[model samples]
Target: MITSQTLRQESEQPRKCFVVGPIGDPHAAHGSPEREAYEHHLGIFEQVIAPACEKYGITAVRADGIAHAGDINEQICRHVVESHLVVADVSSGNPNVMYELGLRHITGKPTIHIGEAGQLPFDIASIRTIRYQRTRSHLAGARKEIESALEVGLRDGFELLTPARVLRGLQSGDGPASVSEIGDGANREDEDSPGLLDDFAVIEDGLDDMTADMEAITKTIETIGSLTEQSGAEMLDLSEANVPMNARLAAVARYAETISAPAGELNTVAAAFAERMVTMDSGVRAALGLIEMTPPDERGEGTEEFLEQLMSLDEAAQESLAQICSFGTSAGEMARMSRYLRKPVKEISAAVQQLTSAITRMGEWAAKARALAHSSAT
Candidate 1:
């Protein structure tokens, strides 16, 4: 007895989508690299993501566009969890972008990934990323690809990603699968399963990112420290040789310029890593809450499998924790050597502190998970 108007109303999809990616430095001087990066990413949002979303009556909002003045991280997390859809630019594998994407994935909502043609990370290379060059033709094609992907997502509804599927006891013994296997809406599961598995997947991915970023950070700090030491030696040699004051000053200026890019990258990545660690801690707490609320009888026959998965995650976290702790100690030493690079070093120290705290919380969650599984097994 339902009319066409009523059917249309019932089938209407939500129209808000949050975009996650690098926005670059807005206050960077004109004609600088930072300014150019800002413009380039902004161009992608306006010329690509916006037009594609407009086709489906969706409004795309970036984190920077929010008009409110509360905590930016809080606002971003809210949009990530509450929005009907999320589109993440995975180019350069930015840590903050990955963390936000992980958050969205935990919700099992509609999400999309896009990136520049050659910059996608190897870890996520198999996922369906809408790759685009800056050329007009490529950008146009990318926009169409996004629209088509969105059309499919809207029609078929959100399916579980690989990590979520495996943790939910839905898919057994599979490593991270390609987007075609899980992301294309081919495999749908029961909605009654506990959401704890979702948080597990999020933490799994976040830990992987944390480990990788920490290694990169360690290498960067070492390189900066070495450069600073070498530059000091060169300056001393120039002075001892009675080099002109103007020439020495010019050499020092050149050395500063050489150090600038890596220093800036270190700051950006460290800040993002700190934010992600905070989010990871929240995920751990949420998982522990789920463990407390889920009774053993409700887990059915999959309790053992769930325990195995929980143990696997704990092992992986332990391995990553070792690497992180090593980096934390080495980075502090390197920072002491290169005191001129204070800003980025400070950020690294802060990130290391936050990550350690998050891992400690994760250990607590693991203990609770083990106990829960033991109760179910007995």
Candidate 2:
């Protein structure tokens, strides 16, 4: 019953900005030059970039730094779309970095661009990119400039700061294609800044999107639970239906020692099947309990650990689902065997009644034959 609206309200809490940059393994086939170039950049990110973002009270994360198992590209894209701000390192002009930066542009949210000064491609060269060199001094200067830009951008709500947004504003500008850039280029005797608007719009959009994802995950979990319960109920019903078969099977052994072989065979199969079901059911129940133990509210200190465990429960649930399907198949085979044996059991019962009638008729026929023989002899 936790609705999307409730989730949205909960997600109103701010999270880290995503830093889009190229930091994959340097030793990759991209050559020693590229490797040496971006290798130290990771450190720069931690020391300068992260600290700058933190100054604005926003946590910053780089793609490789996230501890998750999924498609890396997907995670990066999602982070870019949902993050409070995107700080793109356009230094090496790496394809991946540029791709992510393009996505950020499409959102038109608060984004800060930075790169090495002389290396920028002409395509984006005109944009006011905070440039830095490899030297620590330039790194320090870049941090200061970026920190100031983030503060101002956050304040202005980053409405018209993207390439496309700038173009659109120009297409409609009554003043002129004036300011050299889109944003707090406001004070620039050059760049055109989109005048102020409500600061709440972009935040609201991100919240709505994040909340929708939460709602979808919630629905999936609920569906898995429901299906598990239904399968369990069906298995239980089948177990009850087998009670008569169990009794009849036990009677088979008691009625004739020779029948004990087949009866034991059936019993062995039944016991094995039951044991598997018990084990599978226990696993499913444990997983369900694990999920339940995670509180609706945050678990505070152990929250991350609990959430990780919670994600692992999906594997258990999947295993249970497979077992239930197997169980259904085994049960079907048992039902089929029972069906096949029914005719023989019924025929045996009928033949015993006929046997008793035959014995009575033979006794009467023998008595008449003996009397006729005696009369003939006299």
lDDT of 2 by residue, 209-268 (tens): 423433343343344335435544654665777766576554333333332233333333
The ten-residue window of minimal lDDT in model 2 covers 195-204
Span of ten consecutive residues with least summed lDDT in model 1? 177-186
Best by lDDT: 1
Candidate 1 lDDT over residue span 48-83, tens digit each: 998988777677989989989998977888787667
Model 1's lDDT to the true fold? 0.67
Q: What are the per-model numbers of colliding residue pairs? A: 0, 5
User: lDDT scores for all predictions?
Assistant: 0.67, 0.50
